[model samples]
Target: MSKQKTQPSMIGRMLRHLAGTHAVARRAFPSATLKAIQAGIGEGEKQHRAQVRMIVETSLSLGAVWRGESSRQRAHELFSRYRIWDTEENCGVLVYVNLADHKVEIVADRGVSRVVTRQQWQDVCRAMTAGYAHGAYHESTLQALEQLHVLLAGAMPRDSGDTAGANELSDKPLIL
Candidate 1:
């Protein structure tokens, strides 16, 4: 057998791997969807003293891909980069989505993690992934936000007479 070049296949794979860029993320989560999610987060925080941020990235960086950095690793990096783990209450949670890999991860701070197990967060991510796979992008994300609200609300109830806690973090959805 003779060796053959497979540049086309390699290129195709690379292109697909970089499919989810900021533009793609915006399409998957338009302004309307982002607002809905943000509203949900704002409301969700009212019942609890936890901070939550949702970051959706279209694809992994070329460097990260070259290094075979899994979506989980990227998620953790984003979680820290956004300062989700630096909340005063230590109840920060990050719901990250990587469109290219169809990977979803929920990184919760110690305050929340103390009550919510790793499996619980994984389950939520799985549900979101399933939703994305089904092409129910907006619906799935909103639904996930609702579920997270319930969990956070129960685990970290707000202080007495506190209608809403400080907006420790922006209620905006991040796209990268």
Candidate 2:
């Protein structure tokens, strides 16, 4: 009687080595993509370095700078529709309504829960839900766009031979 012993085949050893090497390769990080992602985050931080007050005022002052009453009203209306409602205790709910696009986005600080009453958020959310529920987003956005156009028309400078036009180049009136 003879006892036979079977060792791992040469091909099996080679395949095992190849599998281990491939696993290491997959775990290796791509340095270029990582650098690009880091650079993008740094740029974003640089852009938002300004204080919160500065950002809020800048958004609010657009109306005054445009120098048009209707546009100003529209701006105010838009603000009234949505603003950073109460940031009590370093927390706030920011609301923005892009009526022209029939979209509403809200970002709230969960860290400061109960900062704003749930009722208010619900109301805005309900309106958005209604639009989505009815598939009326497009129609609402169109209406808002029309309103925005009307406001801009009032603000845009006219070429009606007025002092604002290019025809008024003379510093003094010439009696020619």
Using lDDT, give the best candidate's number: 1
Whole-model lDDT per candidate? 0.82, 0.31
Error of 2 at 76 (Å): 29
Write one digit per residue (lDDT tens) for candidate 1, span 29-52.
Answer: 888988999898888888888899
Q: What TM-score does candidate 1 reach? A: 0.89
Steric clash pairs (candidate 2): none
**What TM-score would every model get versus the actual structure?**
0.89, 0.21
Candidate whose TM-score is highest: 1
Give the clash count for model 1: 1
User: What global local distance difference test value does model 2 have?
Assistant: 0.31
The C-alpha stretches of model 1 lying farther than 4 A from their native spots are 1-13
Instruction: Please write out the lDDT profile of model 2 over residues 20-113, one tens digit for every residue.
Output: 3322322221334224323432332222211011001112122332342232253334433433233333232233332222234444444333
Candidate 1: Cα lDDT at 160: 92
lDDT of 2 at 162: 36
